[model samples]
Target: MDTGVPLSVAVSVVGKRQNPELVRVAGAGKEKCCYFFWQGRNSTVSEKGTSALMTVELDEERGAQVQVQQGKEPPCFLQCFNGGMIVHSGRREEEEENAQNEWRLYCVRGEVPVEGHLLEVACHCSSLRSRASMILLSVNRAIIYLWHGCKAQPHTRDVGRTAACRIKEQ
Candidate 1:
């Protein structure tokens, strides 16, 4: 999957005559996975809120694979209902130096909620170990804030907790 895509948008799936409708909530630019919203009644409701009842096919694929650098930190804070694990990390000086543009690794698995809205956030870390170190930081400080649509900005003081670790591995 292409890493440039965002996976933070909400999408609605409509059922055709032969096909069932499905709703997809995913992060911007990332591949969306199919999540069954509501089962269909004998009759379909009007488009107003009826769109929420559309049935979806279980075989369909949605979000894309999030790409992270091997040995580098991820660029944005990652969130998913199911817990995720760190997979890789890397560094590219040629790329932008901001935290949002840095690279990292993660593997998330869980049932995404379809009640109100779903959101996926991307986070950046300066180093690999620190990236893992900041998992709790991303969850409590970043992910929670984004999920609730809260307004607090991330603090810069929290960035260097893992700085004492070695830079390069043998």
Candidate 2:
């Protein structure tokens, strides 16, 4: 989901398999219902109206990470569906601004691959604490918007909210 695009997109977990899918088509002005959680490979996401596809991969060096490929735009908003919390967020090798890239997210440990499903996002808790369902992730060229059906409260803003921290890759 690229911030450059004005279209509202979301990742929806439909049917069994709990497989995440991108929803782009809907009534005009209707926000796309979407939610996603990834800790490994083979994850599939699609763009609205186009055949373009994207994949989310976990980097052992980078805790709870989403590796967005070039020319791909992930959703800018994110929310947690089940039980989870994003601990510390690893800095992007491409971003060097310490002031802008503050370690806003932190917890007991650093990287928790096994707890991936329990931890929903990797952004400042201040934004998420705003509301229970407020848990969201901020993304850059590969922005990942997370939405949780069970935990998050309804946001007046469509498709949740943007995160304070943005992700970048080299």
Candidate 3:
């Protein structure tokens, strides 16, 4: 939730912003929580696009090794923050040109931190819980779907719709 200066970051594609299967670099060490940080209608990467540059703000310094993964590939670290490092993400120009079907997931935040605001769990349909709400971007990049669990609150539904509309209008 803290989008402050990154501890480290995957700034942009090494070549061009033509790939959404595009950005994410992670280092190893004691595992900790990282947050997705980007600028748009809000911080979420739930918008339609061919390429996007997004980063995670790490809570601590980098680990020994580094790895990069591409879009909707099911990220290992939800957030990246490393004050001392700048990471790059990219692919062959052909790969970028051929890329398609990439999408993003954002879970509705609960009222408190202990409730867990996870981005990865949203990858699985089985992960949809009756107590939560979520926003999903269809792979075709033309539809924004708002999903609410059976037990989700009415207020959360409104918030999800608002957030979806905000991105749609942009």
Question: What are the RMSDs of all candidates, in order?
Answer: 18.1, 16.8, 17.0
- Where is model 1 more than 4 Å wrong at Cα? 1-60, 77-157, 161-170
Winning candidate number (TM-score): 3
Separately for all candidates shown, the number of backbone clashes (residues 3 or more apart, or on different chains) is 36, 20, 14
Per-residue lDDT of candidate 2, residues 1-170 (tens digit): 12111212243433333323322333223323432223222223433212122212222222222333322323232223111223333333324653464333321111222212222335554445433433333333344444333543443122233221212221
Once fitted onto the true fold, the runs of candidate 2 whose alpha carbons sit more than 4 angstroms away are 1-96, 99-127, 130-141, 148-170
**Tens-digit lDDT track for model 3 on 71-143?**
2211223323111111112223434553563554566553322222324233568767798777676646677
- TM-score of every model versus the real structure: 0.17, 0.18, 0.37
Off by over 4 Å in 3: 1-101, 110-122
The lowest-lDDT stretch of 10 consecutive residues in candidate 1 is 161-170
lDDT of 1 by residue, 20-114 (tens): 33223331233335332321222123531333322222224643233322222232322321123222222233234545643332322122211
lDDT of each: 0.26, 0.29, 0.42
The Cα error of candidate 1 at residue 37, in Å, is 26
Could you give me the TM-score of model 1 versus the true structure? 0.17
Instruction: Give the per-residue Cα lDDT of candidate 1 at 115.
Output: 11
